[model samples]
Target: MAMIVQARAADAGAIASLAEEIWREHYTLLLGEDQVTYMLDTIQSEDVIRQAIESGTVYWLVKEDGELIGYVAYDLRESELFLSKYYLKHSFRGRGIGRYLFDELKQVAIENRLPAIELTVNRENTRSIEAYRALGFHVLREHVGDIGGGYVMDDYVMQYVIS
Candidate 1:
């Protein structure tokens, strides 16, 4: 059985390590090795993860049989939940883990009275986009934002409206 635990400051290192592993295995082809290295070093660093947790970004570590398998992180904005990260090990894909995690996200949104959950996914990530669509998410718009190092995130802003 899979379980979710709220991550603390102490878990930042674990999260960062998993992020590096997952990003390298999953994103290397979609985004070149250089970009993957840059993203893991900056956005998914232990320091940044720790800071985000301290700043009220909620993170949950997903575990199965006492082994960490993945993680999810989100922030409660004024009117919606911004899902910053949803990553699992490549071997853990094709199971129901993604949907299980998303169900948890829905519960959190309801508890917080958020009307929607939003996330940005790389436009080329067709598998993830299809998964999100299966969970009732729809594309709201396209976004291209510079994230330093001359790299711009070209993504589709997707949203799931809570009813």
Candidate 2:
């Protein structure tokens, strides 16, 4: 069984490590090795993860049998919860871990009275887009933004409305 635990400052290193592994395994083919390296170095560094936690982004680490396998991060904004990151180890995918994480997020939304949960998924991430659709998320729009380093995130903004 997998359990989600609130990440603390001490978990920064583990989170960074897991992010690097998962991003490389899952995104290298789609985003290229260079972009993957850039993102992991810039966004998933230990310091960056720590700073995000300190700056009010809530991170939850998924653990099974005492091993860290995945993590999800989100921020509550006024009436919305923004899911900034959701990743699982390659071996842990397709095992309902993602759904378990989403279910937890929904409970958080209900507790906070948020109207919806929103996130942006890379346009080429067909599996994730389909999973979001299965979970009742709808595409709000498509957006492309340059994230510096000569790379742009071409993504679809998806939202799950609370019913």
Candidate 3:
């Protein structure tokens, strides 16, 4: 059985390693090697992840049969849950794991009395956009933010309203 467990600060290094592997395999084509490397070093490094966790970002690890296969990270905003990161191993795709993780997010929203869950998806990442749509998310708006290194994230801000 796959279970979701809260991640601790000590788990930051493991999450960083998984993020590198996942981004290289899945995002290199869309983001190119240079941007992926830059984002990894800046946003997904172990120190950064540890700081985020220490600052109250909630992280959950997806463990299946004692192996860590994926992670979800989010923060509770005044109005909604801000989903910062959601990634699974390439081989773990198409196994309903994404839906499993999403169900957990929904529960978090309910617990926090948040009205919705929001996340930004790269505009070029059609696969993820479609999956989010299937989960009842809608494109709230477009966003293009410079993440330094002369690269920008051109993404669609999406929201899933909870009932």
Candidate 4:
């Protein structure tokens, strides 16, 4: 295991690459290639990343020996923490990076004195649901989020009570 670093604005490209890989490897199967591409192109745009940093949404890149392998992007809303994006390089999956990332994010939520952490995951993604359940998050409600056009994020809003 190598020490990981939470990257800053200069690390945007590395995190963007990780985001693209995550979109392709994770969402492409469920959402299809075009949806994945649209998401990557739009959400991972340089301008969008710059805006994220400017907006104070903390983006962290996991680096080992100076090589980027994963990243997490999240934001705080009052007393709640929202996890928007969390992923590892496709090749790095199953090596405990996802678990570590989640743990770290949970800590972030706790450290900020947030009452709970909330997230939305596609209802069809049982793997992610199971993972969240293992980490003590419970489904709160089912809602469909429109990403754009006919693409919608059919998700279960899950929350983890930290305190």
Candidate 5:
């Protein structure tokens, strides 16, 4: 059975390590090795993760049998929860872990009185787009943002309205 634990400052290194592993395994095919390397170094570095946590981003680590497998991070926006990162090890995909994490986030939305949960997913990530759709998310819009280093994120803004 998988369990979710709130991440702490002490878990920054583990989170960064997990991000490196997952991003390399999954994003290399979609974003290319160069972009993946840049992203991992800039966004998923331990210092960046710790700064994000300190800035009110909530991270939850998923562990099974005492081994970390995945993590989800979100921030409470004005009236919605903005899901910034949701990743699972490639080996752990195709199971119900993603849904489990989504369910947990829904509870968080309710508790915080957020009306919706929103996230931006790479438009090319067909599997994740389908999974989000399956979980009642709809595409709100398309976006492309330059993240420096000559890389741009082409993504679909997806939202799940909480009723």
Candidate 6:
């Protein structure tokens, strides 16, 4: 069995924990230790995550047979949906769950009448880039995002037309 849902404010703490876990794994390869620590400290704090989950769109804990597996956070900007972040437990990758999760999110955006969806992914993350491309996301622009550390993410702004 699999379960995934839009988490309410009450689930904020758990969402923060999942974000911390994902960042720890994802940033280790591209950032220095101190920067990674700083990134986590600044971004994964209870205050920030609590606000994001409470006010933004956060889909919590993809579960199989009732076991926790992954999460995603997003925000709507006008007619566009911006993905804040997405992550699965390290062991859960390659199971095609990510695709299913993304599909659901896209439906949510379209059903809500959003015209487009956008997300930024690391330029060096070829695997994710390919996955996004496969899902009909086109590279709208090459860009960089400063994630509040000395480190900045070199990314591609990918867009999917949802209308």
lDDT of each candidate versus the true structure: 0.95, 0.94, 0.95, 0.80, 0.94, 0.78
- Where model 6 places Cα greater than 4 Å from the true spot, the runs are none
TM-score of each: 0.98, 0.97, 0.98, 0.90, 0.97, 0.87
What are the root-mean-square deviations of the candidates from the true structure over C-alphas? 0.7, 0.8, 0.7, 1.7, 0.8, 2.0
Q: List runs of model 1 lying over 4 Å from the truth.
A: none
- Model 5 clash pairs are none
C-alpha displacement of 108 in model 4, angstroms?
2.0
Q: How much is the lDDT of residue 14 in candidate 2?
A: 95
lDDT tens digits, residues 6-48, model 2?
Answer: 9997889999999989998889999999999999988999999
Shift of residue 44 alpha carbon in model 2, Å: 1.0
Q: Output the worst ten-in-a-row residue range by lDDT, candidate 4.
A: 1-10
Candidate 1 similarity to native, TM-score: 0.98
Deviating ranges (above 4 Å) for candidate 4: none
Positional deviation of residue 108's Cα in model 5 after best superposition, in angstroms: 0.5
lDDT of 4: 0.80
Q: Where does candidate 1 clash, by residue pair?
A: none
Clashing residue pairs, backbone N/CA/C < 3 A, model 4: none
Q: Summarize candidate 6's per-residue lDDT along 37-127 as a digit string, tens digits.
A: 7866777666677777766656566777776677777887887888867778878887888888888888878877998889998888887
Candidate 1, residues 10-44, lDDT tens digits: the string is 99999999999999998999999999999998899
Pairwise TM-score winner, candidates 4 and 5: 5
lDDT of 4 by residue, 21-62 (tens): 677888888888998888787888666876797789888878
Judging by TM-score, tell me the better candidate of 2 and 6.
2
Pick out the ten consecutive residues of candidate 2 with the lowest summed lDDT. Answer: 92-101
